[model samples]
Target: MGPSRPERARREAVAKVRDQILASLLSGRYRPGEKAPSVRRMAALTGRSRRSVHEAYRQLAAEGLLEVRWGSGTFFAETHPLALAPETSAPPPALPAIPLELRRLAERLELGEAGLARLVAYWAGYARDHVELAVVECNGEQRGLMARELGETLGVRCREIDLAELGPAGARLRRVSAIVTSCCHRDEVAPFAEAAGRPLFTVSMDPGFLPPLLDALARGPLVMIVRDRAYGPVLSRFLETLRLPPEQIARLAVVEPDGLIGALAERDRPGALYVSPLVRDRVGRLDLDGWRELEPRRFVARDEVDHLWAHLAWLRARAQP
Candidate 1:
C-alpha cells in the first residue's frame, strides 16, 4: 500500500531537511571532517521538528555523506561520492585591473602584443611557482596543523613558525608572500608581519563548535584539551563571550595534552570531551569508548580564505614593469 497524504507530507518534510543539509555539505559550508550543527540547533535553524532533523541525519549517515560518531556528534564524512569538480565550480574572483596593468607594463617596456602575451604567461607562472605563506602560532603543534591546512587549501608552500620565535625568523618571513595566524594572536603577530612587510591574515574559530560546546556545558562537566598551557587561557577567554554563567564556565575545564587522560578519568558523568586538532590523534589512542566527544579546533572561514586569495591575486596583478 502507498503512503497516505499526511504520511507523504511527513516524508517530504524529512527529504527537505536532508536536501538542505546535503546542499550545505556540497557547497563547502561545512568542510570534510567538520562537525555539523547539533540536531536541536539544526531543527531550530531550519524551522523543522527534531524528529525530522534526526531522520535527515540518519539518511545522510546511511549514505556515508555524513558520519555519526556515537558519542562525538555527527560530522561531514571525510570522503564522499559527491565531490565537486573544478570545472563545475565557480572561479575565484578576478581583479579587474590585471589586463590593464599587463598592457601598461608591456607598453612601458616597449613590448608588442605578442610580447605582452609572453609577459602575462611568465608572470602567471612566476606567481604559481613562488607562492608561499607563513603560519604563525603560539605553539609548535598548532603552527604545524594550521600550516598544513593553509598549504592544502591554497595549494601553496607554508612556513610554520612559533610566535615566540617570530623576531628571529625575520629573514625567513621576508621570503613568504604572507603571514597568517589565529585572530587571537593578531596583535601579537602584527609587529613581526609589519617588520617583514608581509600581509597578515587571521583565522577565526569555526561556528560548528558552539552548539556542541554549549550543550556540553549545560549537561555536565566538560574538558578542553590543548597542546600548550598558554593556549588554554586564550581559549577560556573566547568561551567567556558565550555569556555562560561563572558556575557553568567552572564546569568547563581546559587541560594540557599531558593531563587529558587524567581529566577524562576523573570527569563527571553525562559530560562531554573536546580536544584540539593538534592533539586529536593522541586523544583517539585513549580509552574513550563511551565518552561523549564534542568537536574542537578552528577553521579558516571561507571569506577569510577568499580574501587572502584575492589579495595574492592582486599582488600578482600589480607586477612591476
Candidate 2:
C-alpha cells in the first residue's frame, strides 16, 4: 500500500533538485540565454550526486524549461512556463456542489444542512475577526519588526513566534489563517504550515533599496557583522550568489551581542561595514557609526507591503458565505 524506502528516497531527490533549480531561476541568478550552473556545480551545492543532477536536468529539459547542448551547457528556455497560472482575479468561492451520495454520507455523519451551515459560518466568521498572521523566525528582533510592519500594512493583528515554538501539532497553528515567513525560514516553516492546512507566504524585498546596495558591493568588498542565527548564514549565501568572494568579504558571526565592536578592536576590517538591519538597533548602542545595512535580498522582490495586504484582503473576502 505504501512506497518502499528506495522509492520514497528517489521521489524526494527529484523534488529537491527540481525546487533548487527553480529557486535559482526565480531569484534572477542567470541572464536570458546565459548558461545555468553546470550539473557538477549544482550537485556540489545541493550535496547530491552528479548522476542525480544530470537526471533532473534531463527531466526539466523534457518539460521545455531547459535546453541542453552537446558541448556548451544547459540554459533556461527564453520563455517561462507557468502551468495553469494564478489569475489576477480568482473565481468567487462557493460551497462545493456535492453529489447526492456524498450528501447522504454527510447527513449520516451529522454534517448535513444546519450542521454544514454552522461549519461554514464558523470558518467565515473566524476569517473575519480571528485571523492572525504569525511570522515564525529565529531572530526575535527581526521577528518583532516584521510583525510590526505587517500589522501596520495589513490592518490585521499579527504576532511573531520563534521557529522552535511552532510545531506541526499545535493548537496555536490551527488558529492561524496563514503563516508569514522570510525566504530563509521557508523550508523550515513549510511543514508546520502544511500540517495545519494554512498557506505560507514569504514577503518580498524592496527593489529600489537593492540596486544601490548591489552597486555598493560592486565597488568593493565589505565586512559584514552578522547574528549567529538564520539571517547571518542566509545573507552570506545570498551575497556569495551575487559572486562576492568569501575571502574578499570578511564576515563576523558567532560573536556575542555588542561584542562585535570589541572584536573589531584589532582585527582586519573592510573599507565598509555592512550590518543586518535586525541588529542595527543593538549596533547603535555602541559608539560605532560607519555601517551600511545589508539587505538580504529575500528574493520575493515586490516592495509595497500593501500589495500583500491587498492579497490577504482578497483571501478574506473570498472566504465569505
Candidate 3:
C-alpha cells in the first residue's frame, strides 16, 4: 500500500532530527561516550514528538554515531570526530573577497536562486571574520605535513589529529570551518562528509569514487585530488553530469610526474606542495608530464570550490545594498 502524506512528513522529520544530532556531534557539541539529551529533551529542543527523536536516536545508534546503554543513557560515538582531520595549529585565514569571474560562472550554473542566495549568506558570515578549520588525516606523518602547510599559509593555529583517535566533543567540532582528508578511501570519507556540516576535500587513490563523493559532500566545498590518468576520462564525464561549462573545465591544471616538480616550483603560492618523501617515492616515478591535476584546495581555501560558491558569495556581498 502507498504510504500516507503524514507518514512521509513524519519520516522526514525524523531524518532531520538525526541530521541535527549528527551535526551536533560533528560540531563537537556532543562528546564521545557523553550522554546525549534524553529523547524527551531532544523532542522539546527540536519541537518534534518524543517518538520522532526516539526513532532518530535509535537509528543513529545503529549507525554507530551514538551508543545506547540499556540503563545508562545515549552517548555520542567515541570516534566520531576521528571521521575528520584533526584541528589545525591556528584558525583559518580571513575570508577573502569573492572573485568576479567565479560569480559569473556560478550564475550560469543556475543552482536554484534561493539555494544560491542561502549559500552566499553563509559565505558572508565566514568572510566577516576568521573561521576555524579542522584537518583529519589517517596517519601522524600526514598530520604533520598538513599542520606545517596550514601554519605557513593561514598563519593560524592548526590542530593535527588522527581520525582513529577522535572522541566525542561537540565543542571541538563546531569550530571547524572545513575538513580536509588526505589519501582517504571512499568509505572512510562519506561518513565524515555526512557528519561534518561543512565541505570536504580528499586526496583520492581511486578516480571512480570521486563523482559520488563530490555529490555526497554537497553542503559546502569538496576538492578531490586524482593521481592517475585512467581516472581523467571518468572525471571528465562526471563534470559533464554536473553540467560544468567547458571554459570552467579549462581552468583545471594537470600535473605530470616529470613536470610536477617544475610546475610546483614555478608557482610561488603560499600553499604550494614541496617534494614530500611519500610523493617522491611513489607518484613521482610516474610518467606524468602534462596531465591535469585538480588543485581543489587552492579554490576551496580561497572561499569557493566550484564557480557556484564564488558567484553566490559575490552576489550576496554585492546585494548587501
**Candidate topping lDDT:** 1
Candidate order (lDDT)? 1, 2, 3
Candidate 1, residue 161: how far the Cα is off, in Å: 2.1
Give the better candidate number (1 or 2) by TM-score. 1
lDDT for model 3 comes to 0.47
- Model 3 lDDT, residue 97, Cα: 37
TM-score of each prediction? 0.54, 0.46, 0.30
Count of backbone clashes, every candidate in sequence: 0, 0, 35
Q: Lowest summed-lDDT stretch of 10 residues in model 2?
A: 81-90
**Which residue runs does candidate 1 get wrong by more than 4 Å?**
1-129, 140-145, 285-290, 295-298, 314-321
- Stretches of candidate 2 off by over 4 Å are 1-129, 138-142, 184-188, 209-230, 251-257, 266-270, 273-304, 314-321
TM-score computed on alpha carbons, candidate 1: 0.54
| Candidate 1 lDDT, 1-321, residue by residue in tens | 234578557666776786577545544466778888999999997888999899878766755668888889999887643333324432332222234444565576564544444444433443455678889988664676677656654556688888889889988887887889998889998888877766788986556646787788888888877666575565567678866787777787777778876777776664777777877776564446666777554555655665665555422322110
Report lDDT (CA) for all predictions. 0.66, 0.56, 0.47
Segments in model 3 whose C-alpha atoms lie over 4 Å from true places: 81-321
Give the Cα RMSD of candidate 1.
Answer: 24.8
